[model samples]
Target: MRIVIVDDDPLVRMGLKAILQSEEGWTVVAEAGDGSAAVAEVRRASPDVVLMDVRMPGMDGLEATRLIVDSGSPAKVLVLTTFEVDEYVFEAMRSGAAGFVLKRVPPPELIEAVRVVATGESLLFPASTRAVIERFSEAGGYELPDLTEREQDVLRELARGHSNQEIAGHLYVSVETVKSHVASILTKLGVRDRTQAVIVAYESGFVRPGDAAEL
Candidate 1:
């Protein structure tokens, strides 16, 4: 996967580039010092993934993510943040970031996160992510879409961070059936992926952080 590392700190960008380069089939196509430069680099590189730092001098990662998504770039943004409950990280999610990873994450897990987001899968950090959403997300402002009872159940399972296989086993249904429910849920919620779906569930009072055990 081609990736652009965007961070104001030169050392952080260099470190991330080194870590990503050590992985097979991953390339550091470009690097940017700040959010505005990151946007330009993304346009130039056309990378599959962007490792975005949430805070920057000029545009910031959140605005950069918004511009990239609005411009119809296919690159998936994976935000890098120091704080798990950062308000900017939540805004980044709203701007269409695929997911976020902490800067202090172990190299293996960080590499895996990049791969997962690059493959068009949402990376939900169970404990910290859920806590952040629950803390910041206001309840009962927006109306939820019409979902069947089974779909609601599936959504609840999803909010609990269950994979399709796990949701299937829990619901006593086939994995294919669970996948169907997930797709339907995503469509009805008007969200990109499972992470956004779970965010909606929490924001809509459909699920609470304490309701599920952390993975």
Candidate 2:
């Protein structure tokens, strides 16, 4: 996977580059000190993923993410933040970030997050992300689509953070079947990914925050 690291801290950028370069089939194509530089680097490198820091001296990651996404760049953004539940992280997601990981995340998990986002899947950081979604979704009040009973079952599993493979196993179906359900779910709900779908499920009262365990 090709990646660009964007952080104001030199040491942080270097450390991340070292970690990513150690892995096979991964390359650090570029590095930028701040968000503006990040935009330029992304445009020039055309990387598959960007590890973007939230706070910076100028043009913070949230704005940078908006510009990148609005510009229709294919690269997915994975925001890096020091705080676990900052409002800026939520803003980053709204700005079209694929997901976020805490700065203190373990190296293995960080690498895994990059791989997940690179593959066009949304990364949900369970505790932190779910909390953010719940708080914001409650305010926005999502509207549910006309999903069939089986689709609702699939959505409930999705809201619980189950993967396509895991959902298939739980529903006694194939992965491709789960993918089909997921696509239909996205289309019906008029959302982008599973993360947004889950948010809608929660906001629309299709799936309660506590329903995951009961389902």
Candidate 3:
């Protein structure tokens, strides 16, 4: 995979380059020191993925992410952050980042995260789920979508990380019914998957990040 590294810290950029170089099937296409530079490199290099630092001197990662997505750039962004707070996590997701990892993450996990994102799977790291929970908890109460009571129940169960069978059993409904509800939930939320739906749920201010006590 062709990848670009973007960070103000030369040490971090160099370290990432070394690790990426050691991995097979990966190449460091370009490096940038700021968000604007990152965007320009993305347009020029057309790398498959961009490893971007969340905090930058100008055009922070969130704005840069918005610009990249809005520009229809093909490169997927993987934000690197130092914070575990809900604010940063939710902002990154809302800004159209494919995923993010803490800067202190192990080398192996970082490689896997980039690989997963490049392959188009949303990274739902434990920290990510915690951010989502905080988003829901702060909303006073969960935002109710346009669904029946049963459907809402299924969605909540889903946000809690329940499987279809588990949700069915919890609600005393059949597996098929749970599946149908999940489909309906996705439709009403206009999301492509449960992950995006979860993001939307928090972004819409319907669920506060702190509201999650379970899942």
Candidate 4:
């Protein structure tokens, strides 16, 4: 996978590069020190995934993520944050980031996160992610846009952080069928990935935090 590393901290960038590049199939295509630079580098490199730091000197990752998504770039943004429960991370997700991960996560997990995001799957920390989204979303919930009954079912399972195969089992559908439904959900919701779909599920009250608590 081609990748871009974006962080204000030089040491953090170096460390992440070392770990990610250690994988034979991955390449660090570019590096940027802040959000604006990240945007420029991402546009230039067109990497498959961008490891973006949430807080930076000038433009923050939240806005950078928004710009990247709005600009129709295909690269997925996987936010890198120091705090798992950060509001910035939540906002970044709404801005169309694929997911967020704590900076202190183990090397193997972090690498797996990139792989997941690169594949267009959402990476949820499960506990902390629910906290951030629930804490920040409106309490009363927003009215859901028109979704088919099957799509709604697929989304509720998605909000629970189930893998495609697991959701397939629950719904008694083929894995490819679940994937088709997920793609349709993303398109209908006008969101980039599963992370944003989960946010919509919670905010729409289609799936309550307690409903997904087990995940």
User: Each model's number of backbone clashes?
Assistant: 0, 0, 14, 0
- Order the candidates by TM-score, highest first: 4, 1, 2, 3
Model 4 CA deviation exceeding 4 Å by range: 139-141
- Candidate 3 lDDT (Cα, whole model)? 0.74
TM-score of each: 0.91, 0.88, 0.72, 0.94
* Error in Å for residue 78 of model 4: 0.7
For candidate 2, the TM-score is: 0.88
Please write out the lDDT profile of model 2 over residues 1-215, one tens digit for every residue.
89999999999999999999989999999999988999999999999999999899989999999898887898899999988777888778777887788889889989888888787554455666766665665534566778888899899887767778888899999989888989999899876667767777777777665666534
The list of candidate 1 runs beyond 4 A from truth reads 213-215
Which segments of model 3 are wrong by more than 4 Å? 132-195, 203-215
**Strongest candidate by lDDT:** 4
List all candidate RMSDs to the true structure: 1.9, 2.2, 4.5, 1.5
Candidate with the greatest TM-score versus the true structure: 4
lDDT of 4 at 184: 93
lDDT string, candidate 3, 8-50, tens digits: 9999999999987789989999999998998888989989889
